[model samples]
Target chain A: MFELILTLVLLVIGFVFGQIAEKRHFRSIIQREAETRDLLCFNERRIPQDMFSPHVTLVCGSVVVSVDFFKHFVATLRNLVGGRVSAYESLLERARREAVLRMKAQALAQGATSVWNVRVETSSIHQGQRQGIGAVEVMAYGTALVPR
Target chain B: MGAYENRTVPEGINVSPVHPLKDFAVLLFGVSLSVIAFVIVLALLAGYLVRYVPFSYEQSLVSRAVAPWLEPSTDPLDQQRQRYLQSLADRLSSVMNLPDGMQVTVHYVQKDTVNAMATLGGHVVVFQGLLDVMPNENALAMVLAHEMAHVRYRHPIVATGRGFAVTLALSALAGIGDGVMERWVGQMGILPMLSFSRSQETEADALALESLQQSYGHVEGAAALFEYAAAETPVLSLPTLLATHPDHEDRIRRIQVFAQEHPPAMAPQLQPLPDYMKSKAKSNESQ
Candidate 1:
């Protein structure tokens, strides 16, 4: 019974560490997303007339978080050590979907019908810099146009 | 008596002499296990490091290291060509509604390929072969308009951004595994990025068409230029340009449809070239 209790305590401690790591990772991703969106906002204002399409300019934006965040988080767990790398694949997948969805929502709010020329850019911004907050920012933007 | 009691053994057994060899063996075993574990942890950390480091930072470092090895070009003919192209770009910009403080410069290349492109910071380059094939001012304008669209849309800057993003994303993924797996992620991600570039091209084309319509009276000239290009170059076909622009035939069809559905408010009034310009063209053609 004593051994059982000791094992339970160890497991709880490991779980707590995993949660803390995961939270840090999540915060970084969100902060990066905000920085990228800010950059895109700046770009929107600076577009010249030559860049503007008379028919319609559709701007779609997206962000992708690094998979390493989840990978590192899982690896840090003592019990999860030696397991297949695929153990945390689903978490990364979920993050990617969430990031893309948030971007789509922003694009929709901007009154874009369809986004063309879709391209994604990524940057690493140091935390506490005036320009951005996060380890890296991934941004996707393209002309949003109404179909003729 | 106290010292003797401390050294006493409870059982009646012989006290053996200390063995340096046995002590060394146990110590070696413990050290070996520790070394192995340390190596395993370091290996994992190294894998993560490789993934997280930005590729651009490495590229810049290498380029700086090799800067002395690169040769600088000093051809007078190239300089003259560049000046002529720059003058032409100035003329083109004077007729368009350009944003204040934005400067457009043009360069002419001696290459035989029929291609023209624009880079960020308003630098445009046209190939000599492309000039030879355009046949008329309107055709040249069409090409210029397209290149301008690329600049106005800031495609180059956006493209560089996308490239940087993908590299970082993949590098971060690389941290998740061994070298072999990281390489696989990099290779697999390339196709999606290429597709994304193709979409950007289409967007640029649409914008170019609209710009042409607004700047010129009729969208017909733009359409005619595409037709001429399609006839002159087999590579301009939709499949070939799909990476940058949609199929030429598709583009032409869309322009025609667009023209028919929504005619411009006023027909484009094309200005005749000056006598001096016409004479220059005639002389150049004879030469």
Candidate 2:
């Protein structure tokens, strides 16, 4: 009986806090992306020959996000039924967007006009196979070009 | 650089548009319903198929576990009580027309718990507390016949098989989650199992009433045990849906109905319990 009550309480907490945190993170990512829009980033590797006195360097941003109890529970159930786990979808989206926003911010701080060969990578840092996915790390990296 | 520009993409494209809660609700509903349905079907299948398993195999499987139940008592009075109870069960089984090779062994427990149960291997354990409440031998026969009916119908093995299958499924699902997930899954599984068990109780009751009519020429004392049960337990019982046994009142009403349909040709005679069985007060003092 105690375990049942604890599960319910934890689930409610996970849902409420997870939603609030996800919404806040998405809002921040959008605002930051707007602020750093001029810091162009692309997967294209080409560097323009017309630029004078170009300074090139590496810029990267990475963040790790963990799953909440409620989403984890929903995902576990989803595993049994074999369907799209929408709960984890938004978490990944938020993480990937935030990583890109951070990478753009880093380039803008370095006075870079544009970035090239931008790439994003993801890895799951699991507690263990039985313990489930504890967190995911997303990194965005690129070559920033600043004109001197 | 001359023509390329990083245009801001639209929001909320990567993630699904469905609300998480809505997704969760649908998945929970669908999964729970399927699990319940699966368990019920599996239980029914297992229950039906388990009777084909030879009774001797079940007896061997439970021989070690029920060893304590079959242990002989050192006290002379207890031995005498056990013999008397065994003789009564033997008489009941003779009239019950149990299937060939299905033997009923009655064990007398000196404990104070007012309960009796039919378990695997055709072993029935009746507690002293229950015998204390019997107003006559007919009431005692009803209790014994109810358990014997469980054996005759192969309910113990069917229930065991059903439980085994259901637990296997539930545990397989539970392996994916931690303690909380396991508990949640177990809770969902319990509802169907409870309903199945209640129906078994009702079926056993019907058979027991029939056996009582055959043995006693009427079921005049068949409801006496239930009367004691109703009086001893508080009136506030769990609803019939949640209870393992049918409600005491409902069981009594069923017996009354059965009595009306099969009236005795002569005045009903309620045989007194043996003198040794009469000392409910003495048994408690000895304990």
Candidate 3:
């Protein structure tokens, strides 16, 4: 009787410990981004011809989050979550907002009226077999047409 | 308190039956513990079996078994096609900045089936039927790019690992029941391969677009290529393939959105076929 009771207790304890371990593993993976910045570039043809400011042209900009940083965050989060729905949503929202703000800043810097056809992308840099990181990455880019 | 004590029943009436209750509790506890112990033993046995027999050996055995069943196509242009494919692969390697000792091989099958595929270890095969329908070099490059993307992404190996785990699990389950196990093994053997192929196709598409933007300067060709494939091929209608890559329209929309957002770095310089090859291609078209 004592042996039976002890076995039952051990089984229950094992199940509880398993659940706790799984949850802790999940929490560790669900980390948030620490810092981020935009990778910027400009193109001359993206602006309307009518907008004229001497020595000024449309500034087309792109944003590339550090592939290493973004991947680390994603992998850690992926360990906790089964699906990418929540993570991708957070990433896309942040990327879109950041892209718009950066484009506006570029336009203002050039003293232009507004930017047009702003776009964003998510891409990855593929390196192989690194620890605690994703070989895949996400990158975002947009076009900002300024005066000239 | 004194009035309540005065109202108490006789000894037998007040006392409970401890023996029967204790016996029932002990029996229930014993049965549950036995079941738990049995499950633990089975689990440990499974873990031991897996540890002893390496998964790679099983994979190779399966691969060899399947190799005999796969139908090989016979085509006359297989050699010339191979040469052209090699040249294109060389160009892609240089453009993608791949490391030394990496090799790519292309196969041309004579089958009239409208299909093209890339397997692991950099083997790419395209059916004559698919080639016959392609309108231009860019469209062809789109297909090649998609396949190359599979290689670059290492999707095939990942897929193989997943397939092995699923197969092993199913086989273990089926081993317990003769009537159901046979049917299940038969079904799984056929279905999993098709599903894996389909998933690789989708991954290739996504990676191919990324590769196109990075190497060729735009994804316009990739989008057009997918549109063409959707129109020309009915392979997507297969149940197993459909399960992996559903909604052609969704894929098109996603690719277009991606292309729009990440425009190519520079305008792509189209590479024209050599004069002799162009003439031969024209003659083939005329025929």
Candidate 4:
């Protein structure tokens, strides 16, 4: 009986807090993206020969986001049904966006005008067993082009 | 870079626009519903298949596992008590029309727990605590017959099989989640199992009441056993929904309803307990 009550309480807390946190993070990401709009990013490897003396440096940003209890529960359920696990969708979305934003910030800090050949990679870091704490690490790396 | 400009993509493109709660509600409802349905079907299949297992198999299995522990008492008085209870059970079974080759073996236990139970292999155990509280032989017959009814319906085996299947399946499903999810899944499985047990109890009560009416031509004292039980234990305090057995008050009400529906032809007579049984009960109380 105690376990049942505790599970219910944890579910409610996870859902309420997780929802609030996701909403707030999304708001922050949108606002930050608007502020950093002029920092250009591209997947193209070729650089123009006409471009004036530009300093090149490698820039990278990485972030790890852990799953909330409610999303974990929903995902466990989804495992049985074999469907699109929407519970982790927004989680990865946040991680991927955050990684890019951080990479852009790194380039801007170096007085770079644009990033070339940007790349993003994601991998899950399992803390313990299969059902234990789960988090995803996303790393965005690119070459920054700064005019001297 | 083409034009060297990064256009701001509109929101809600990558992430699904479906609200989290809506997705959660749908998945929770659909997944749990299917799991519960699957469990129920498995339980029913197990219970149905178990009934096909020969009663002799159940008897042999229990004899190997449990019968040795239920050794008959060596004390002369205790043996006499066991014999008397056994005879009473035999008499009730004769009128109750128990299926051929099925028999009830009554074991009189010398304890003071105020409890009686029926188990596999048609074994009904009557504790000394329960015997001491009997108001009359009629009430004793009601209690004995109730256990006999459980044996008649093969409830013990059916319940065992059902519970085993459900637990095994639920535990396997629970392996997909952590501690909290495991507990939650287990609790869901138990609800159906408990309800099945409660319905079995109700079925036994009805059959026992029928046997009581047949034996005494009236069920006037049938409710006495539950009344005595209710007085001794706070069993009625538990919520009826969760308990395996129905509340004592609910059982008494059922007995009263049965009696009212099938009026006896003659005046209701509650038989007094035989002198040896009464003496044995008194001796236990004194000790």
Candidate 5:
């Protein structure tokens, strides 16, 4: 009975904490996305030589994200019915946005008009022996172009 | 599609569009992982609960699943032997009061193992080795009744359900401990092979006895198989607790006590086992 109660408490904590954290992250992500709107980012490999100036270098941003207990519990249940895990979807979306935002900030600092040839990579890192939470690392890299 | 390729920018607008393979890959990986997990967990749960629900479906499902593995032997001798076994089962089941299930159809699988099992959809599988050892009609009836009780109470269904639940729970708990998942997975592998609860076994035994007395007017060789095992050292070495069914001696004692309380109308006389079966047993013993 005590164990059940403890589990319930942990679950409640996970839910509350997860909600607050996710909300904060989404708000920040949106703000940064708006700020970085002017900075052009392209996945195209070919550089627009006419638009491209001489000053070019590498810019990258990396971020790590881990899910809360609530999402973990939901994922476990979802593992039973099997469909889209929106809880996890948002987790990745946040991490990806954060990584891109950091990259955009770096490009702006470099005085580049836009970013091109963008790439994103993600790797999962699970930690905690008995009660470990798994985390994902998302890294965004791109070439910044400063037009003359 | 619109790459610069050393040309002038058309709109001089937004940067390149996303061609996110890695993102999709992760999504696919997560979804596939969840789907696999869901299938295993749901199957386990459904397999457990399906017994309580009555249907003719389980029988056909199991038969179809096992069809490819079995050699389709339509030999006359085999058919005759199977018919005999089925007729005996039909006779035994006619006397043994059952719930709403079909007349038990006993299948004679030509395996040299001393075992019998009752499964979903009123199917009783009798091994050739079991027929070889039975000493008399009464002994055979006793085995039949025992298996019938399992069908009556849906013991197989309950057992499978429990096995599935145990496997799922153990795997879930594995996340909390070091080196626990491996052990849990190993245990899941063995849980299905376990026997029903001791109480379920006891119920089946008691019901079998009731059935034996009703059908034959006495529980004569009800304890014959266990007695044989006791008289001779068994090949396998398993403790009573580990055995799914109760120890034959203990079961015999229970039968005797029940018999004393409710004596049969006719005193049972020992009948000799059939010569063919006896010979088979003898051949197996020598081998």
Candidate 6:
């Protein structure tokens, strides 16, 4: 009985805080993604030789996000019938976009006009395997080209 | 266009975030409810499927499956006492209402744990500690008959199958429910798991009492051992969920009441524990 109450309480807390946090995060991610959209980010590895710039360097950004108890609980339910865990899908999607935005910010900071060979790597960072993903770390990296 | 050519690309565009919390929450609730219904259907199907397995095959399957974990007992005392217990089992089996083709094989485990269990394949694992504690053959008879009742009804195999199905269901539940159900599933794969339903326990108890009534023509001291055990039952015990047996105290009272209603045809005379078994118990205890 106490456990049920505690679970409900945690769910409620997650619902309130998680909903607020995710909305805030998605907003930030959207705004940042749009801002970074024009930055020449690509997965292509051929670095355009010397045409771009001699100031070629690596720019990377990473973001780690955790799912609140409510979302995790939902994802676990989804696992039973074996469907897409859309909750975690959104989680990873948010993480990846945030990572990209940060990487673009780093490129802009370096005065680089464009970036190429963009790579986004994601991995599980915590032991929420049985449940849903506890937390995820996403890192976005690319080679920045400056017109130096 | 000239300004854009010279300026850093679109200074990080910002769009207002959409409101999705309400929709997400509602969708999650809907999905979870359906998932719950789906799980119930799966459990019912698994439960239904397990009942039709042929007795011989179930016995063979369960025996082979649990064989590796038995860790065969080598103690000399175990061998002697097992023979003692088996003969008693044979006597009771002769008179008890048993299922067709169900032959109880009593396996002696050398452990001192004061408990006995009926597992899959009509396997009754009796520990040495239980033998030492029995005041008389009557009490021991009660134990064997009780386990035999479990066998006649195929309780252990049904439980094992239930455990298997439930564990898979719980795995599917995964992150949805609280951690408690997961812990419950963790206990499933092992033998001698889960407390039998109260109905099953009562059924076994009644059957044992009937067997005692028939075998001795009088049931006496059969429940006395449980009275003693009830006194020793710990204040802190497994949660009802984890308890493999009914509370000895409550069960003792029930057994006494049950033994009285159907009076035995004659005064019961219980055989005392044999000296060889007593000596073996002492030696094993010393070790």
Each prediction's DockQ against the real complex: 0.01, 0.59, 0.00, 0.62, 0.06, 0.15
Question: How big is the positional error of residue B260 in model 2, measured in Å on the Cα after superposition?
Answer: 3.4
Output the lDDT of residue B103, model 3: 52
Decoy 6 TM-score against native: 0.59
Residue pairs that clash (backbone atoms under 3 angstroms), model 6: A31-B14, A35-B12, A35-B13
Rank the candidate models, highest TM-score first.
4, 2, 6, 5, 3, 1
TM-score (C-alpha, index-matched) for candidate 3? 0.42
Interface RMSD of 3: 29.9
B174 Cα displacement, candidate 2 (Å): 3.8
Per-model root-mean-square deviation over C-alphas: 32.6, 2.7, 34.0, 2.3, 13.8, 8.3
lDDT per residue, candidate 3, B11-127, as tens digits? 222223234224334533453354334433443354344533343443365457644443443533455665776677666656665434445556666666666776655567777
lDDT of 4 by residue, B1-287 (tens): 23568899998877767777787788778866776777789989999999998888899999999988899999888899899999999999988998888999999888876778999999999998887778889999998999999999999999999988888888787667777667667766666777788899899999999988888899988888778768877544657777788888889999999999999998898899876675465576669
In model 3, state the lDDT of residue B255: 81
**Residue pairs clashing, model 5:** A41-B16, A42-B16, B48-B161
Compared with the true structure, what per-residue lDDT tens digits does model 1 show for residues B1-287?
11111122232122122232343244334433543344334433444444443434433553466333332226554555456556655655665556555566566666667788876555667876676665455556667766766665555555655566556555664544443334434444554555556666666666666655655655655565567667876553334422445566777887778677668787656543233232244355568
Q: Which candidate order results from sorting by DockQ in descending order?
A: 4, 2, 6, 5, 1, 3
Interface RMSD, Å, model 5: 11.3
Model 4 chain B: weakest 10-residue lDDT segment is: B276-285
Docking class of 1: incorrect
Q: What is the lDDT of residue A121 in candidate 5?
A: 98
Lowest-lDDT window of 10 residues in candidate 3 chain B? B1-10
Worst 10 residues of 6 chain B by lDDT: B1-10
Which number leads on lDDT? Answer: 4
Give the Å error, residue B36, model 3: 23
Q: What is the C-alpha local distance difference test score of each model?
A: 0.51, 0.85, 0.50, 0.86, 0.69, 0.72
What does candidate 2's lDDT look like per residue over A1-148, in tens digits? Answer: 5777887898899999999998898888888888887787889887777753458999998999999998998988888788688888999998988898888888888889898899999999985667664689999999999988
lDDT of 1 by residue, A1-148 (tens): 3543553464456456644654675566555555444222222333344334555554544454433322332322312134333324433433443455455556666654444455556555443443221244555555654333
State how far residue A138 of model 2 sits from its true place (Å). 1.2
In model 3, pairs of residues that clash are A29-A76, A29-A77, A58-A146, A123-A137, A123-A139, A124-A137
